[model samples]
Target: MPVTEPIRVGRDTKEELRRLKVHPRETYDDVIRRLIDVYRKCQQ
Candidate 1:
């Protein structure tokens, strides 16, 4: 099994994550992972 962790964010940041979702059913983890992938590509 994989271990999970929690992190805190401001209300505005939470709202921004929701807005970035590709679909209503998408998970925040997916959104964050996608953002991380983009950031990695940009740094290359």
Candidate 2:
């Protein structure tokens, strides 16, 4: 398992995620990791 840290995120992003049903149990770091990975793939 990866070590996770708490991050303060924007309310709009949080609300959007809830609306999209992205499993609220996930840590913010997980969400960031997925987003960054996607961005990295897009850059390739």
| Top-scoring candidate (lDDT) | 1
lDDT tens digits, residue span 1-44, model 1: 76678989899999999999999999888999999999999999
What TM-score fits each model?
Answer: 0.88, 0.57
* Model 2: per-residue Cα lDDT over 1-44, one tens digit each: 77756767699987765554468687556666787888999999
| Candidate 1 worst ten-residue window by lDDT | 1-10
Q: What CA RMSD would candidate 1 show?
A: 1.3
lDDT scores of the candidates, listed in order: 0.95, 0.71
Instruction: Identify the leading candidate in terms of TM-score.
Output: 1
- Measured with C-alpha atoms, the lDDT of residue 25 in candidate 2 is 82
